[model samples]
Target: MIKNFHQYYVYILSNKPNGTLYIGITNDIQRRILEHKQGLIDGFTKKYGLDVLVYLEMYHNVNDAISREKQLKKWKRLWKIELIEKENPKWSDLSIEWND
Candidate 1:
């Protein structure tokens, strides 16, 4: 027997350190981030220029990813900043190398 696995991502995008933030969930982080960077998706992210991939969490279950995304979205700005800084001290774009 064979089993297949699916990946989901709970990601955070920001314009700069302590700047506007966006929380989202997607199965393809690369493609999703690319779309945001290209302004292909309209709304909050595009309006605020939150294209930098500042933080991310991956899971095999979509529900888990969605739950995490929603939870993060409800978090206070300072808490979110600390979460990002814990993993990304300088708030550098984690997807900077994916320039396309």
Candidate 2:
């Protein structure tokens, strides 16, 4: 028998351009982003308002996503910023239209 699994994502959120950045991995990217946007989950995201989904990289395996997130977390701030700019030069909230 075979089972289907949803893709995982390493996502980055920010308060503003050149502002605070938060990196995380999730299986349900949209739901996680919504939670961050609504301040549903407490801690860094809520306190810093790091609610703008600036970047995302999808992975077929959760292990890959977890590994990427960990690597991003250890990167120098400038490198992470560069990664975000590569796809999202404007640092737009990529999750704002998840419902659409």
Candidate 3:
């Protein structure tokens, strides 16, 4: 349960538990997560049904978040799985859906 407000985050969204990962960086984590959840943005994410918030890392600076996002993107799938498992063992979606 994340309660802190932060500026930037390196987040991973998935189509399902441990399925089809999409890595991204965002300043407004909640809003961006919501957007993906609702399929509001049309692209690879929307196409792949990448809505589950499997992993996230908050950062105070955009540069750090972007760098982390890039590094994660370059990593092999196994490495990404290890990184996610280190924090989110069950691979659960963290987004608290605010939609009515």
Q: In TM-score terms, which candidate is top? A: 1
When sorted by TM-score, best at the front, the candidate numbers are 1, 2, 3
After TM-score superposition, the amount by which residue 71's alpha carbon in candidate 2 deviates from its true location, in angstroms, is: 0.6
Global local distance difference test of model 3: 0.87
TM-scores of all predicted structures: 0.94, 0.93, 0.86
Which candidate achieves the best lDDT against the true structure?
1
For each of the candidates, the C-alpha root-mean-square deviation to the true structure, in angstroms, is 1.2, 1.2, 4.9
Each prediction's Cα lDDT score? 0.92, 0.91, 0.87
In model 2, pairs of residues that clash are none
List the lowest-lDDT window of 10 residues for candidate 2: 91-100
Candidate 2's displacement at residue 33, Å, is: 0.6
TM-score of 2: 0.93
lDDT of 2 by residue, 16-98 (tens): 99999999898889889888888999999999999999999999988888889999999999999999999999988888666
lDDT of 1 by residue, 5-52 (tens): 899999999998899988999999999999998999999999999999
